[model samples]
Target: MLKKSHLLCLCFSSTLLSGVAIAQNAVIVNGKAIPKTQLDKLVQKSGQPDNPQVRDQAREMLVTRELIIQEADKRGVIQKESVREQLEQSRVGVLVAAVFEDYVEKEGVTEAELKATYESMKSQYSGKEYHVEHILVEKESDAKAIIAQIKSGGNFEDIAKAKSKDPGSAPNGGDLGYVNEKSLVPEFSKAMVQLKNGQVSD
Candidate 1:
C-alpha cells in the first residue's frame, strides 16, 4: 500500500541503520576502525585494574582522541609543514633508537674484547711502587748524625719520631706508607728505587 518514494526512503533508512550498527560493533570512528588491542594496550599502560569500568574509561578516551584526530585530518592540520617536520623528526628518533638497540643485540661486547681492554689498561697501573721514610733536618750535620746513629743500631723510627721536622710524618714515626715513583720528587724517587728491601737510604 506504500507509495514508491516511501519504499525508497525506507530502504535508505535501513541501510544507514545497518552501517551504524556495524560501526558500533567494530568501535569505528569516522569510518576508521579502532581495534580492541589498542584498548588493551591503553588499559595496560594506565596501570589500572582490568575491570569493566577501567576498560570503559579507556575506550572513551580512545574514542575522544580518534574524534580529535579525524577533525584534525579534516582541517588539513596534519598536512602543515611544521607538523610534517615534527612527525618526521619523531620518526627518525624512533628509527635511530631501534637501530642502536639492534646493533647492540647483534654486536655486543665479547669477553675477549673485555679482557683485551683490561690488558691494555693494566700497564698504566703496573709501574713501580715504593714505601719510604725520611728524617727531615735543616743541617747536614744533623742528617749525618741521625744516619750514623741509625747505622749504629739506634731505632730509626724512634729517632724520626723524636727529631724529624716534617709535621705530616713525624707523628707516625716518619712513615710515608706505599707510594708510586711518579708521585715522588726525582731525587727521592732515585734514592727510593735504589734501596734493597729493609735497607735505609742515607
Candidate 2:
C-alpha cells in the first residue's frame, strides 16, 4: 500500500509521461505541430501520397525555419522597431495590391478600345528591314569625300566595306540592321530620317 505522497508522485509521473508521449507522436512542419488526422487531410488536399521527396523537402523547410526563428529569438529581432515597420509596410502593400487588382478586374480595357488601339499602331509595327550603307572616317573630310563618291554613282556599300573606319559595321559594308528612331543617337537619327531611298547624307 502506498502513502498519500507516493500516490501523488505516481499521478504526477503518469501525467508527465502522457505529455511526453503526445509530444513525441506529434508531427511538426514549418514550426506548427499537426495531428495525424490533419496530416492525412493535407495529403488528401494534395491529391497524392505525400511522397518521400516531398516529405524530405517539407522537413528541410521546417528545419530551416526553426533555425531562423531560433536565431531571431537570440537576437530579439521580433521586438525591433524596423521589424514592426516592415511588417506594417507589407500589410499596406497587400492592401494596395488587392485594391489595384479589384480596379483592373472591374474596369478592364474594352474590346472596341483594344481593337482601335491596335489599328492605330499597326503601321508602327513594320517588320525588320534594313537598307542602309554608311562610311565612317576619323576626319570629317574623308566622310564627305566618301559621301561625294556615293552621290557620283559609286557603290556606297562597296566603298564602306573598303574604307569605313568602324570595324564592326565595315566588314558588313556598314549595313547596320533596321533601327528605330530611339535606337540611334539624336544627331544620327535626324540625319538618317532625312535620307530617301538610295540617298546619301553629309
Candidate 3:
C-alpha cells in the first residue's frame, strides 16, 4: 500500500533504529567479541584511517591482545595472593586519586595556600646528586677485590656485567645512573659523597 519512496524511507528508518539498539561487532576471537566501538576508539586514538584496512588491523590486534589476556586469566595469574594484593592497592590508589581530584575541583586551592605549602616543603628538596656506577657483592672482601680490579685498569662496566649480583643493574653494567644523596642509605651516602668522579667505592 506504500509508495516506493515511502517504503524505502521506512526500511532505512528501521535499519537506523536497529543500529541504535545493537552494537556492530568487528570480530570474535576464541569466543571473545571485539565490538566496533572498541575498533572505533582505537582508530580514533591512533589517528588512523577508518577504512577496511585499518579496521582489519585493529581487529587483528584486538584478537591477539584478548587471546593473551585470556591465556593469562586461564593460567590463574590474577589468583596469586601477591598479585591480588597489588591489584587491590592499584585500585585503591586510582580511587583515592579520583576522589582527591574531585575534591580539588569542588574545593579549589588558593595561590596563598599553595605558596605556604611550597615554602614549608622547599627545604626537603636539596641534596647532592651523584651520577655513578656501582658493582654490589655480598661480601666486603669481594667488593674490595672488584674495586682493585677497576683500579688495575679492568673495565668497570664489563666487570659489573660479569659479576654484580644486583640482577637489574648487572645486565646494564651496574649503572645506578643518577641518585640523590639523601635517597641512599647512610653508609652508602657517606661513602659515595666523598668519592671524586670516576672513583669507585672501596
TM-score of each: 0.39, 0.36, 0.59
Residue-wise C-alpha lDDT for candidate 3, range 1-202, written one tens digit per residue: 2365673221111111134333777666666666778878988887876887987677667777777667668779789886788899999999999998898899988899889989766654565578877887999899888878889999999999999998768888999988877777899889889999887776
lDDT of 1 at 18: 45
Output the TM-score of candidate 2: 0.36
Clashes of 3: 0
Which one wins on TM-score? 3
Model 1 segments more than 4 A misplaced: 1-26, 109-202
For residues 13-56, could you state the per-residue lDDT of candidate 1 as single tens digits?
Answer: 11112454544442666566677678888989999889989987
lDDT value for model 3: 0.76
Q: At residue 50, what lDDT does model 1 achieve? A: 94
TM-score of candidate 3 to 2 decimals:
0.59
Deviation from native of the Cα of residue 145 in model 2, angstroms: 1.2
Q: Which stretches of candidate 3 lie over 4 Å from their true place?
A: 1-24, 40-61, 67-99, 116-128
Candidate 1 residue 138 C-alpha distance from true site, Å: 74
